[model samples]
Target: MTNYLQLSNITKTYGHFTALDDVSLSVDKGEFVTFLGPSGSGKTTTLMIIAGFEKASGGKVEVGGRSISELAPHERNIGIVFQNYALFPHKTAVENVYFPLQMRGVSRVQGLRQAEDMLSLVGLKGFGHRHPKELSGGQQQRVALARALVFEPSLLLLDEPLGALDKNLREQMQIEIKRIQRSLGVTTIFVTHDQSEAMSMSDRIVVFEKGRIEQVAAPLDIYHRPQTSFVAAFIGESNLIPAIITSGAGKTAENPTLGAFQYAGDDALADGQKVTLLIRPEHIKLSRSPVEGRKNARMIVETIVNYGDNALVIGRAGDIPMRVRVLGADVVIIKEGEECCISWAPDAVFVITK
Candidate 1:
């Protein structure tokens, strides 16, 4: 089967600086993929190139085996939703959604009917008559989304469309967007720096760093089996301890300060090879005394951040900083400037050689 979208060794350069370096990937039909990275990490650059807004200096972009490398932005038949809902002030919500079809010579009556159907799909059934200025921020966003999908484009690209909304609304739209995308089965590439958003929405996430693809995997796989140190640290809160493989065949590593950590995995590494150990904050249990049946360490509690239902305890386990997540109710048992026992099972440990 042909790939829905294929980016082959895409490269972008501006004079002397390189924005993207030999980046290549493929997206399956109806697949929801997220491009996740920090600022200047080339996620949006790749999105723009795929949309035909920023031409790649090299390589080809194909949709269903047809190269669109030389096509204009509008010629690509890709729907894009921007951070700012780019709606015309004069156009009503239905008109805004109708504009795409209108550009294709859709009649006002037929286009308005199709536009209203899309608006209803996005939960703006009765508000299609209002202009962009009259609609709420969230409503305007819905209009923008409806417009993007009205044309039945081959691919949909979302460029941080939820960035302008508040926390709750942003989260609500995440679910709504996912629902609509699944209903339409449109191939999508969503770009955002928010790891939680990526974690919650994407079928697979493409991690980008310094203009390169770091790793591409399912959300849980990316979190638990990160391919690089950058991915382990970027995806979520982690305690990364530098260690050396004591006995590679034994699946054990020795940290200078945290002591020995027995890992659970079959990795091929030479004995005494240097590696990084990743233990998530939630995996560590804090206690007043050493926990039984696990690797234990004494940490001096340096800080406690409470979040109603859960809390993060940041401290030092020997010279290495450690973070532990605990129930908010249990946080009352520990105080900063005091020593607490932190423990984790062997399976909680992940080894990153790179």
Candidate 2:
């Protein structure tokens, strides 16, 4: 199927700094895609270009296979929700939602009815008469969302919509936003620097860096099978170990420290070539008794931290710090500064180029 939205070879620059560099991506219809990265990573810049708030220095923005570069922001039929809940203080909740419809030439009676329905859809029934100041942060966000959807735009663009709320409210709103988007089947694009938020809500995440695309994949794939070292480090907590590819067949390779491991299928580095191995904390296993299967894996526990639900065992292999997360019944009665052997399956280690 053709993508509902397409950004082709897009580039954006501001003075001496480049905000986006030949970034291209596609969003399928009804897909919830997120642009995720740290500050100044060009995630928000890409969203602004797509929303027509900023013009691309090069390339084109397409919606539903049609070029939308020349169209004005209002003419593109896209709804945008800013970080701050942009509700008018003087207007009631219903009036704020109805404003969008009224701008499109809908009658007062019809706009009010539609706005009321939208308020109800966002779980704010009977809140039409309330002003922005009277509602909680979550409620205010709901109103802002209702206003964005009231116009029935072809696409929805959320620019850190939950950034202003407290942690608890932000999480609650994330679930609500996902639920509402799924119910409406709206093609949505969310921009955020929070990895957890993107992982929870996105069908796929596009990790950006210094005005360029770093990696684009499903959350699990991005975490476990990152194509670059930057992606493995950015998406989640990982222990990066520098190793040489000793031997291999297909994607499986043998490392000196972690023993035989599997990497990307396209990895074709020669033997003795320096490569970095990405191992997640949860992937490393700790055993009080001798580990029977891992003869080639070399590791020794250096420190242990009890964190209630789980224990973080810091292990060392050569000069690198290997973190292992022990949970469930396995975490019972493990003291800090104790010696324990740590090992991981060959397939659990993903090697990436530095």
Candidate 3:
């Protein structure tokens, strides 16, 4: 768990337009961290800075306890895979993988042999003879990955490597990439706007927003206990309600439309404090009538979105929009434009003060 990579007070600016502001983070050796955010949120900018392709306005980029800020992208000894596989169409897979080692003065015989071994690690051993055009998108990605890892760089940066693939291939590559990353034990940084991709592949997720880091935590923590409203709303389907604390010690808050609610959290909230209550859609139970002993609300169903195994019920409860997740079979019990009862226990409510 040693801090193998450190970005201390990193900042980037283009004239008066600041792209990143005082951004800093530490990554442990062999840890898989994903930089997740929307476009223009600085995630890609941070990745570029770390790769030495973009210089920082301030602060340092360190790897293995040494400063790499002064190094060129090639001299930094880091591997990068972009959204485009960036394979040489004319070169065979093995040859493409060997190109990096070839540049470093390794003999073609030795480099190709090492490249073959790396290709095997990425599940492309027998297919190395095929040119980029002969390989499928996923296989081409594996070749690109093998090429990046062939030199055994200090770090591996994947910038939306699965972006161009079909859905099934993207998911399959997620597993393969993680397997290859774990096998190599390379400290890696992944950049993506895909939330589910980040959630599935990362050991930790760093959420960025408006040129700053919003929160960094495990996937579940970032989803269930997000420190800010942005993080809560950004990571998943959430019904966020604005409320004022009526009794901090009582663990209660009151919304003008939804009435009083008991939230579950250990934060030190004060009476009359403004806050937001986050209730995940899945936490709610949609029923015909009030479920005794649980908090209940009447929602006029507006839209029903079904996804084979489950469905989302979107509607308004009083003045606040609400969403409830129900199994596909149970969703038949209600219809759009019909009123239904949505209930949940106190523990289902999470408080967001930020």
Candidate 4:
């Protein structure tokens, strides 16, 4: 795919503090890309740079083979939706959606009709007459999305657009956003620290930490084959065990507390190489006794967090803290403060050398 948006060596700073460091990435046309990381990781900074809201210390921002780095935010033909929907309280839903078109010199008669059509497209059909206060959070979100797309922008930037809603509404909007994005096929950049949001919505995920890009890959690849320990740990709940390669040819590693482990990878690992082994919580099995044909460890159950469908068993095997995810029904077999058996297959372990 051709690169529709290009950020080359983008850097940002504030006095002595560096916010973004030589960050570069290419986005394909119509791809829904997510910039995911914790606060101050430069994901929002990069989005602002692309939108021409923030000036990069040193870099080039290009869109559709043209440089837009020097353009004003309004001149960049990009639509931005922030954490707050930022709808006008005095205006009706359709009026809010039509504001951008009105600013572009479209006639009210024409713009309002177009806005109504766009609202219908976003599942807000007859709600055009209602003000922001009259609409539900999800409806307001849809109104915001309609406004962003009403102008048919070259790019759409969403900065944690669903951060305000409660859990159920947030999930509902996730599906709606993905549906709308797919229908419009607009090249989009979504910024959020929520892992599940990034995993479910993006065509590709850009992971950031400490103002640097950690890994850029599909959501599953980023989870299963992370190139760094930070990516492995940040993307999900993981048990990261420090180990040294005992047999590179045999795909074996030795951890001081966890003993020997057989990891799954084909990297040209050298004997005595230090690495971190990533084992996700759901990959482990918890039972009363050690299971046959799997690596087992005895863990002292410390805490149990139940979430209806599943339960998180947090405990320690020796000094190594571990977590196991089991079905809610199965979690009843173990109690806190009791010794239980946890086992995993060899292929469940991923080796992260970085």
Query: 109-203 in candidate 2: lDDT tens per residue?
Result: 99999999999999999999999999998899999999999988899999999999999999989999999999999899999999999999999
Q: How accurate is candidate 3 locally (lDDT)?
A: 0.95
- As a TM-score, model 3 comes out at 0.99
The deviation in Å at residue 225 for candidate 2 is 1.3
lDDT of 3 by residue, 302-321 (tens): 99999989999999999999
lDDT of 4 by residue, 1-354 (tens): 679999999999999999999999999999999999999999999999998889999999999999999999999999889888999999999999999999999999999999999999989999999999999988998999999999999999999999999999999899989999999989999999999999999999999999999999999999999999999989989999999999999999998888997888878799999989999999999999989999999999999999999999999999999999999999999999999999999999999989
Instruction: List the candidate 2 regions with Cα displacement exceeding 4 Å.
Output: 250-269, 295-307
As for candidate 3, its clashing pairs are none
Give candidate 3's error at residue 128 in angstroms. 1.5
Cα RMSD of predicted structure 3: 0.7
3-100: candidate 1 lDDT, tens digit per residue? 78999999999999999999999989999999999999999999999999898999899998899999999999999999998999998999899999
Model 4: pairs clashing at backbone N, Cα or C within 3 Å: none
Choose 1 or 3, whichever is better by lDDT: 3
In model 1, where is the ten-residue run with the lowest total lDDT?
1-10
